[model samples]
Target: MNAKKLQKKIFPLPKQVEVKDGALKLDKVALKITADVHTAKQAAAVLEKKLAALGIGVCDCAKTTITLALGEAPAQVQFAEQGYRIAVTADGVELTGFGAQGVYYAAVSFVQMLDREIPCCEILDWPDMDFRGHVIESRLGSDLMEKEDWFAMID
Candidate 1:
């Protein structure tokens, strides 16, 4: 597929992307956390749950493994505090993040990319702004929002 077509599969649009010639099959996969990457386990847990809900089994014997790690971007690539890079290939996927938040974001994107088909690509992305928030005015009956409602909104 073309670059634009592959990019359309992702939300918020990554800053840099290079589409490749093949796709990765995620029918069954494993989550691998690199050494010293503390936050990656939590992010992988979230990813595991998300994948399970979609009928994707997580097992140690799976051939396709999603590896998460905390590392520096290549010298040519510049990433903000919450930046991440995702490299998807036929063999597996590598998610490298700058921080804990970046790891979470990378997992989020990976989940999104799992819809339909996952093309082989490299994505380098970072938020344009430091803070993202949502405001609920009291006038709009925000007081009536329940705990479950808030959790759903956050999810």
Candidate 2:
């Protein structure tokens, strides 16, 4: 595992053989991403597919639409971003914003973390850098780059 990169971190996800939600019994596994549009929807879709592959039912995502922020490199990372956050949760997890990406990576990481028949664990993590950028700050607005004007240039 790469110590500096988050994907290296491994943790276990609880295997709930039975789940009872209030008066209803649901073997269904629940999840929600409290984040903005594009990323949130994409993340929710990806998670649902992965869970189905594992034979686990995906519950539901919190909401559909997300509001764009003022100006914080307001775009989703295509190949995923590297950070210091990714943790296991009790039920599942509630991840939001750029921080939520970390959770997505962690869920995948948790799958790899399990030993033979091992189950039930939790983790708490967060990234140090708040801003995630795909382009170099210097090349942002120039004719060479031609990126959006709202993009921020961190010094």
Candidate 3:
């Protein structure tokens, strides 16, 4: 699919995105991945393993043209948790986040992008909040709790 069509496939849509003209064909690119922190490094390793399954290997030599950086996002970028940015250019892919968790999410987004065959695109995204909560109601609560329980708890 073309990059434009694949953009919508990403979850929690990126704040900004740009689809470029050229695609990063895995078969034609020499991909290299590196990270500045341990967490990001581990994430890169995970990506390495996944790509290996597809017969793509990571390189550290000078010939490496497509570099994937799993690292902390610059301080200016605001997403604190589970927020990330991914940019895919003709020459390389750069993934950044506020911290380790963000870095992981960045990788996740990248993988999602790849899954959709979206080869050339740029994305800027971040979560609005760090915590999420959900509530559920059930009639079984009445059977499980006694009046004494409610009075004792109230005390």
Candidate 4:
């Protein structure tokens, strides 16, 4: 997959992207989370579920591993509160986030890029605005919103 093509496929487009030759083919993968980072664990679990839906299994050991961690952005780049970097290569995929919210976003982006294979690339992204919200007006509907409706809206 071409980097340009992949970029177009991703919603809200990443701030920075670089692609190299070849792609990483995913079969079974090992998911590793940074110790002490509860958000990383949660992000890994979310990714695992998405992969399972694609018929890819995750386990304790594998040639290909996806790592989730909370860390600083590369020196040249200053990440916002919810910024993240995703690097995919023949070696493996590394998803690093600046915060808990960043970790969740990183997992979401990685999941979006999944297919039979992922293009070898690096993506740096963050929301333009620190605050994002949605307001649902109950007045428009005759019936009260169910719990599932709220969850669905959030998703």
Q: Which candidate is the best by TM-score?
A: 4
TM-score of predicted model 1? 0.76
Residue pairs whose backbone atoms clash in candidate 4:
none
Q: In model 3, where do residues sit more than 4 Å from their true spots?
A: 1-4, 28-34, 61-78, 115-118, 132-155
Clashes of 1: 0
RMSD of each: 6.5, 12.7, 5.8, 6.1
Error of 3 at 121 (Å): 1.2
What digit string (tens of lDDT, one per residue) describes model 4 on residues 1-155? 67788888777788888998878988889988883567777887789888989998788778898988877866555445588989999878998888888888888888888876888999999887778565775536588788887888779
Show the lowest summed lDDT stretch of 10 residues, model 3. Answer: 132-141
What ranking of all candidate models by lDDT puts the best one first? 4, 1, 3, 2
User: Which whole-number lDDT from 0 to 100 does residue 59 have in model 3?
Assistant: 61
Once superposed on the true structure, which residue ranges of model 4 sit more than 4 Å away at CA?
Answer: 74-79, 135-155
Clashes of each: 0, 2, 0, 0
Query: Model 2, range 1-155, lDDT digits (tens) per residue?
Result: 12322223344322111222222122455555444445556556665665566665554452221121111222333322422123223333333233445545444444454221222233333334555446544553546633453344332
**Please, what are the lDDT tens digits per residue for candidate 3 over residues 61-114?**
523244445456555566565667787765567777666677777777776666
TM-score of each: 0.76, 0.38, 0.65, 0.80
Query: Which scores higher on lDDT, 3 or 4?
Result: 4
Order of candidate numbers by TM-score, starting with the best: 4, 1, 3, 2
Residue 70 C-alpha lDDT in model 1: 77
lDDT of 1 by residue, 32-115 (tens): 988366567778888888888888889999999899887775555444557899999999999888777788788888777774
Question: In candidate 4, where is summed lDDT lowest over 10 consecutive residues?
Answer: 73-82
